[model samples]
Target: MTHVMACIDYSQSSLAVCDYAAWAAQKLGAPLTLLHVLDEEKYPAAADLSGNIGLGSREHLLEELATLDAQRARLALEQGQHTLEKARERTVVSGAAFPELKQRHGHLVESLSELEAEIRLLVIGRVGENSNRGAQSLGSQIEAVVRTIHRPILITASSYRRPEKVMVAFDGSPTAYKTVQMFAASQLCEGLPIHLVMVGADLEDNREALEKARSMLISSGFEVHAEIRQGDVEAALHVYQSEHGIDLLVMGAYGHSRIRQFLVGSTTTTMLRTATMPVLLLR
Candidate 1:
C-alpha cells in the first residue's frame, strides 16, 4: 500500500489538507499517517521570557526559567498529540481507516525527512489564515518542506471536492511521465475528464508532447483533450485553466539543485503562486 504522510498543524488550512489526504488515501487504498511536528526550539526564547517565576536571586531565576522552558516544550508536545488524535478521528470518519498519528518534537523538515524512507507522498496545506500575509504565497514552512523532502508532495489549497476536471502540464520529462502514470493508475480522477496541455516557445515540440500525452491518457481509459499554447508557462497555464474551468492542475518538479529552480523556475512553483486550481506536484 502507498504510504501517505500529511503534515497537520491544527489550522484551518491544515484541516483542509487532512481532508484531501483522506480522500487520496481512500482512492489509492493507501495507509495514511498524520504527522504533527512541534518545533521546541521555536519556543525556547519565548518560554524563557514568559515563564520567569522569579524563584529568588538572578541565578536561581535563570535556572527556574530554563526549567519552565522545558516544561513548556513538553506541554506543546502533549497538545500536538491531542490534536493529532482529533485529526485521526476526522480522517476515519471521512472514509479512511484510522491513520497512524505521529507527534515529533523537533524541526519540521528534519522530522519529515527522517520518515522519507517510509513515505510515498506528503500532503500539506497552502498556508494558514493566521500566517503572515506575505507568507501566504510560498511560505517558509512550505518552501522548507518541499526543498527537503524527496517524496512527492500534494499541496492543498482548500478542501478538495472530487476533482471533475484535471489539467496535466506536460513537458515530456521523466517526472511528468510519472505524474501521468499516477493519474492513470488511480481512481482519483476515475470519471473525470483530463486536459493535456503543453506550453512552450516551440510550437512543434508542444504539439508533439501534447499528442504523446494524449495517447498516454487515452490508453489509460480516460477521455482526453489536448491543447498546445505559446508564451510564458505560468501565464499560459492560468489562461488555459480559466478558459477550461480546470479543477486540478498536475505537474512535475524538475531541477538538479534547489537553486537551479531559480533559473528554470519549476512549473509546480509557478502554478502554486498563480494557478487558481489545486496542484498535484510530482517529483
Candidate 2:
C-alpha cells in the first residue's frame, strides 16, 4: 500500500511521469511502479466483427478479421511489456532504484480503482496517448481518477524538470488546510521554498487563515512565504508561479473558491492547458 504508482502509456507525457514518480519515490520512501493498461476498448483483441459484415462479404474475410484481432491483442501485450521495461529503466535512472513494472488489461479508471488501496501517491500524465497535448486536453481517464479516486494525484505535464520552489494555492478552507497538512507530512518538497498564495478579496479573515496555514508549515520545518493576491485564482497562481520560479503547484481538489473550477469540467482543462508544471491535487 505504499507504492508510488505512476501511470504511463508511452505518450509524450509518459517520460515526465516517470521522472516525477522517481522523485516521489525518493521523497515518499516508497517503491516506484510503472503501470501500463492495455485498454480493451481502445485496443480490442476480439471486437465483434462477425455481425457487421456487408451483404456480399466473404466468410473467409471474417476468418481473416478474427486472425487480425488475435494478432492485435498479442501485439498489444508485447508492446505493453516492452514499454514497461523501458519506463522502469528510465525511472531508475531518474533516481529510483529497482522500480517495479505492471501491466493490466482493462479500462484505465477501473484498473486504477482496483489498485486504489495500494497507492500512497498516484502519478499520472495529464494526457494519454490519444490526446495531443495538455492544453484543454485533459483525458477522460484523468478526469475519472481525479473525481473518483480517494488519494493524492500528482498530474504530470508533457515536460517537467526537478522543482526548486513549491507553491500552494490556498483559500483557507478545510481542504486547503488539509492540503497544507498533507504537504507538511510528506517530505516530497522538503527544504524547498514555499509560497502560500491565496487569491480573493483581501478580507481580514482570509489574511488570518493564510497566517494560520503558514504557521503550520513553519512548525513542520518548511521555509514558508504566505501572501494574498487579487484577480482570478488560477491566473494569479500561474503568474506568480512563473515570476517566482515556482515549478510545482499544489492545491486541494475541492474548495469553495473558484480554484475548484480548475479541478472539474471544461474550465479545468482550459486553465491547466497552459500550466506546463505539474499539479499536486490533494484528496
Candidate 3:
C-alpha cells in the first residue's frame, strides 16, 4: 500500500490538507503520517541598541527572551499535536485508519527528505501565515519542498470536500501516465466523474490521445468526459474549469530540470500559479 505524508501546521489550511489526506489514504488503503517541523530560529530578536544597560542586565534580558522563545515553541508544538490528534479521530470515525503523528526539529524540506524513501505522496496546504511578514501567502517551505521532493504532491487550497469532478491534463508523457495510473488506483477517483482534457495549438494527435485516455477512464468505471481545445494550455484550462466548475485538476509536471522549467516554462507551473482549483502534480 502507498504511504502518504501530510505536512501539517496549526493553521486551518493544514487541517484541510489532513482531511483530504485521510480520505486519500483510506481510498488507497495507505498509511498516513502527519508531520510537523518545529523551527526554533523562525523568530529572531533585535540587538540591544541601548548601550546604557550593563552587560549583566543585557545577559538577563537575553535569558528572558530565550525562555520566551522556548515557551512559544512548546505551545506551538502542543497545538500542532492536538490538531493532528483531532484529525486522526475524525478519520477513525469515518472508517479510515488513524494517521501517525511525527514531529521533527529543523528545516521542513530537509526533514521531509529524510523520509523520502518511505513516503509515496506528500500533501500540503497552499497558503500559510508568513512568520516574518505576517501576511498570507504560499509558504516558502511548501514551495521548496514541492520542488525538491521526488514523489507526487497533492496540494489543498481551502477545505477538503471529496472531489467529485476531476480533470486530467494528458500529453502522453511518462509523468502523465503515472498520474493516470495513480488516479486509476486511488480512492479519490474511484467511481468519481473524470474529465480528460487535452489542450494544444492543434488537434493533430491530441484527438487520438484524448480518445485513448477517455477509454481508459471509462473502462475503469469513471463517468469519463473528454475535451480537446486549441489555445494556451493554462488559459484554456482556466476557462474550462470556470465554465464547468471543475473540482480538482491532475497534471504531469513537465520538466527534466529546474532550469528547463525556467527556460521553456511548464504547463504545470502555469496552472499552479494561475488555476484556482486544487492541483495534483505528478512527477
Best by TM-score: 2
Candidate lDDT (C-alpha), each = 0.75, 0.83, 0.71
In each prediction, how many residue pairs overlap at the backbone (N, C-alpha, C within less than 3 A)? 0, 1, 0
For candidate 2, lDDT tens digit of each residue in 1-283? 5799999886878888999999999987898888999988767767666676688887788888878877888899899899999898898888797988888988888898999988989999888887765443677667778878889999986786898899888888887899899989888899899999988889999999999999999999999999899997568878998789888988777776455664555334544555768888887
lDDT of 3 by residue, 1-283 (tens): 5488888776667767777887778766789888887765673333343454665667667666767767777777787678768877766665667678888767788898888987877888776544332222345565577777888888776776777788887765555666677677666668777888877645657677677777777777788888877787678888888878888898766533331372135655556656666788776
What value does the lDDT take at residue 259 in candidate 2?
A: 51
What tens digits encode model 1's per-residue C-alpha lDDT throughout 1-283?
5588898886777777778889888877789999998875664533444445465547666777778788787787788898898888888888888899888877788998888988877888877533664423665577777778887778886566656788988776666677688767766677779999877666676577667778888998999998778887778888998888888887765623331373146655666766555677766
How high a TM-score does candidate 2 get?
0.91
Which candidate order results from sorting by TM-score in descending order? 2, 1, 3
Give the runs in model 3 whose Cα sits over 4 Å from its true position: 43-68, 131-137, 185-187, 215-223, 255-266
Top lDDT prediction, candidate number: 2
Global CA lDDT of candidate 2, please? 0.83
- Which one wins by TM-score: 1 or 3? 1
- The lDDT of model 1 is 0.75
Q: By descending lDDT, how would the candidates be arranged?
A: 2, 1, 3
